[model samples]
Target: MENILEASGLTKRFHGLVAVHDVSVQLRRGEILGLIGPNGAGKTTLVDMVNGTLEPNAGDLVFEGRSVRGLPAYRRAHLGIGRTFQIMKPFPGMSVLENASIGALFGTNGGERSIGRAREQARECLAFVGLGRRIAQRADALGGPDRKRLELARALAMRPRLLLLDEVMAGLNHVEIEEVIEDIKKVRDQGISILVIEHVMKAITSLSDRVFVLHHGEKIVEGSCGEVLRDPRVVEAYLGRRRR
Candidate 1:
């Protein structure tokens, strides 16, 4: 499969502080790539740049073989890029269905113009993420896991080509995590590529085709989960941090 998204020499700076430095990554057409790191590793910064939430101080981005540099978030969404924030934000005043409908209303290729068509597509996305039963409930009333599902549903309703999932399993029990792992796999089965940023070791091992590691905003290593786990640098990074 060809590369669906590519980031070259990406860098971000906050005043005098370097947040990300010269990082490069590629996401293939139909693969799940795991990005792991400790806190402040710049993983979220990289995703934000890709999703057009933040501009890179220096870098070039290519999506679907076209340059995407400087595009706004809405433009990126129309270009088939979808993302879920680590701290998800669902519309508090809307029903679950209404919240999801917002995606279909403004998704890829300008999305569905008719409200009825958008709602129909939203329902399918909700069902896929197991939020179908709660479609009528207020978005603010959902529990942690269901909120995660709602986040996924909204992203899926956008009909994206690439999904940037940032810790979608956070705060869930082991059973819920397992379900989410499976659900992500199912999402990839639909021919969408995924870049999963997660701290869960089990999810990384179970879902990643290849794993990449970042530390202090730099790419330290890239390989399979087992390979990354055994690397002396990665081992030291984790163990040394724990000792502090």
Candidate 2:
């Protein structure tokens, strides 16, 4: 498979503190890569840089074999990059369908220009995420699990070639997490590449083709799930963390 994204020597700093350091990663077409790290490991920062929400202090980003380092977030989105937030951002007063419709209207390559078409696309995405019955409900009225599904549906509505999911399973119950895992698998089957940041080991192991681990803003390990999970450094980091 061809690489859809290649980030090399990526770094980020916040007021003299390094949030991410000299990280390099790749995402191949139709592959799912899991990003795992303890809190403050800079996983979200890395995702932010990739999606253009934060500028990397150094390094280059290549998407579809072209440098996207200087592109704005919208331009990257137009280039077929879509992402969900760790914190859900729902548009209050808008119904779930309306909230998702915005993604279809403004996503990749100007998205669906016609409002009617965008709504249709949005409804399709919502139904795919099992939110078909909740389409008319106000966005903010949804519970935690539903909110996560809404986030996924919104991103899916973008018809992204590459999707960055930031903790979509966070706070979800086991059943909800399983459902999302299945939904994500279906998405990958549709040929979308995904870079998912998840702390849920079961979900990550099941979804990822490979796993990358970060510690204190540094890339400590990268390998298949079994290899990385059993690495001494990874074990030590988590073990030390649990004792803290």
Q: How would you encode candidate 2's per-residue C-alpha lDDT over 1-244 as one tens digit per residue?
A: 7999999999999998999999999999999999999899999999999999999999999999999998899889888999999999899899999999988987999788999999999999999999999999999999988999999999999999999999999999998899999999999999999999999999999999999999988999999999999998998777784453
Winning candidate number (lDDT): 2
RMSD (Å) of each candidate, 1 decimal = 1.6, 1.6
Kindly give the number of clashing pairs for every candidate: 0, 0
TM-score of each model, paired residue for residue: 0.96, 0.97
What lDDT score goes with residue 212 in model 2? 95
- TM-score for candidate 1, please give it: 0.96
